[model samples]
Target: MSLCYCNSQKSFKDCCEPYIKGLKNAPTAEALMRSRYSAYATHQADYLVATTHLSQRALYPKEDILLWATSNQWQKLEVLKSTPTTVEFKAYYLDQNKIPQIHHEFSTFVQEEGIWYYVDGEYR
Candidate 1:
């Protein structure tokens, strides 16, 4: 079994695949964050777009999201903290030039109609 891209130590199928495949919704903000990281690693731009909060969707065009996803070689995800509606994490990746980079953020989430959507993030 392939390990989840989110570094959750679970199989991809058991962790993020269901979320990415539209078969299930992430039950919590942290889950959503993990699955979103997995989406980037897998280059599933549509999933990324669909999981963003509606109000912020326009700011994240699918083509741009896809380009960002495909341009990086996602390496790891580190979940530093989580609350009901927030997650702080670091995403490690390699750029197209093969240079290592880290994207650190404290992300906010909101649950609407029992579904969680990523709102925005404060970059660190």
Candidate 2:
């Protein structure tokens, strides 16, 4: 089975490839949010850090992030709403013990040098 999102018609790679590779800027806050979801699903921590605003990136520890990613089976991502600087969504997944869980949040983003970078989020 293949996993894809964002109505991009392309696979996650082809769709969000540039963002993941630091080759292109995310056009909207929602785009950044979706790419972050894909990053979490793939356990691409370096990409995560790269896309996060430097001021807030310190909130997460790399080792703990890797552990969390390894312990979860990411299922799907849903974007409920978004604006130029914020996005609200829910990501569903299963834990290491196979317990299903949902992480819902309203995430904020900022544009720097024409690139969108995640700032922080309010979990809901």
Candidate 3:
């Protein structure tokens, strides 16, 4: 599908493909957030955990996430505001059951060495 971010110039496959496939690293929190959204859309659980903070990595279940992704369709992403280690955005999508949903949240992230990691998020 076409993406609203990146000026709608690229499909999720072309724009965030590397990061979603665990072939490329996300250098920033916002970039990781974007790639994670793409991963969810594509059901790439391995990529999700790979980009997450090591401390919190255990909180996620790869299989469960894969199942959840199968039932959802990611539609759009909006990074309303962001800093080097944080981001506030709205992610829009539709559940497989066809329910539309919007996750508006302020997400916190941290960088260790040179890798960015998702810390937590609060709904807004």
**CA lDDT of each prediction against the hidden true structure:** 0.98, 0.81, 0.77
Q: Give per-model TM-scores.
A: 0.99, 0.89, 0.84
Pairing residues by index, what is the TM-score of model 3?
0.84
Off by over 4 Å in 3: 1-8, 11-14
Per-candidate clashes come to 0, 0, 1
What's the residue-level lDDT of 51 in candidate 3? 75
lDDT tens readout by residue for model 3, 1-124: 7652423357666678867666667777888888777777777788877777788877877877788777777777778998888889888878777899998999999888877788888998
Kindly report which residue pairs in candidate 1 clash with one another.
none
- Local accuracy of candidate 2 as per-residue lDDT tens digits, 1-124: 2446444456876667668778777788888888878777778788888788999878877777777877898888888988999999988999998999999999989999888899999999
Candidate 2 or 1, higher TM-score? 1
Q: Model 1 over residues 6-110: C-alpha lDDT tens digits?
A: 999999999999999999999999999999999999999999999999999999999999999999999999999999999999999999999999999999999
Evaluate model 1: give its lDDT. Answer: 0.98
TM-score-better candidate, 2 vs 3: 2
Give candidate 1's error at residue 54 in angstroms.
Answer: 0.7
Model 2 lDDT on a 0 to 1 scale: 0.81
Q: Report the number of the highest-lDDT candidate.
A: 1
Ranking the candidates on lDDT from highest down gives: 1, 2, 3
User: How many clashes (backbone atoms < 3 Å, residues ≥3 apart in a chain or on different chains) does model 2 have?
Assistant: 0
